[model samples]
Target: MAVKVSSQKDTYKATAVFLVLMGVLYLLDKWIDFSDYNLDWVMQKDTMLLYAAVTFLWFKSDKSVGLILAGIWLIQNIALVTALLGQVSTYLLPLTLLLIGVLLYWLSSK
Candidate 1:
């Protein structure tokens, strides 16, 4: 009898771990905001970071997640446009950060 096994590439495993960690962080931040709306600043910052982490995690192996990020990228762009239209506030630091994250993710996937 012989034993056979399969192993994932280190990059894939690393990306999965990164994605899980980022997802968890985002989930935690979301939970934290449920009780207090005053933490908007901090939540937004963390959310951007979370998006970055998630992007890095799904960089190569997961096209679905990448698509999701693409959607977010579009949404963020629309937010900026809406701000220009006077529909949203001009203080878009967080969305800008998240846009950077989206760009980074796109780069990593390439």
Candidate 2:
């Protein structure tokens, strides 16, 4: 049907946008020096946004896959995130945001 075709097209468009976003973010993270300006928080926040976008997309396709990907993302980012935290209690905010991202994907999953 036309609706399904349009929906698939939209999905493809979203995917392309997401890929572009990831590429830009990766380049910024690798090539730029946010820490030099005490802007590391900005990079961390962008990382969260990237994960959220990926999780949301995966969730729309498959809930189990979304959860799995979220878990894998968390595991992979743990060390750098911990170092980013730089303090015990400060870990709560970012970790909570990541968990909330996972939860949002789980809840919005279809």
Candidate 3:
């Protein structure tokens, strides 16, 4: 009973911190110029929301949810993420798939 109450309180605290961080990031994005740095994508609304969601989930003990969300975000923004990798981006999908397969096999063995 006490553990559940503490967990709920921690979750509320995490939620408040997440909201504050998101608000600060949103304000910074609007007030600053990131175009020259080629980092405007980092300040985009969707990106910020995804980051906040991942952080919130991880802090709330929902690590798998955070990982899955982060993975989805990476897939959705792979082009942006690998923009500097050039040709390397082309092999990312297969490499990622292979890694996932290896992870599954290792987990199953465990």
Clashing pairs in 3: none
RMSD of each: 10.1, 7.9, 3.9
Angstrom error at residue 8, model 1: 8.0
Which lDDT values do the candidates have, in the order given?
Answer: 0.58, 0.65, 0.74
- The numbered model that scores best in lDDT is 3
- TM-score per candidate, in order? 0.30, 0.40, 0.60
What is the Cα-based lDDT of residue 103 in candidate 1? 100
Residue pairs in candidate 2 whose N, alpha carbon or C atoms collide under 3 angstroms: none
Put the candidates in TM-score order, highest first: 3, 2, 1
Across 1-39, the per-residue lDDT of candidate 1 in tens digits comes to 122111235346646766676578669777776337565
Top TM-score hit = 3
Candidate 2 overall Cα lDDT vs. reference?
A: 0.65
Candidate 2 residue 107 C-alpha distance from true site, Å = 14
Residue 94, candidate 1: how far off, in angstroms? Answer: 23
Instruction: Please estimate how well model 1 matches the true structure, expressed as its whole-model Cα lDDT.
Output: 0.58
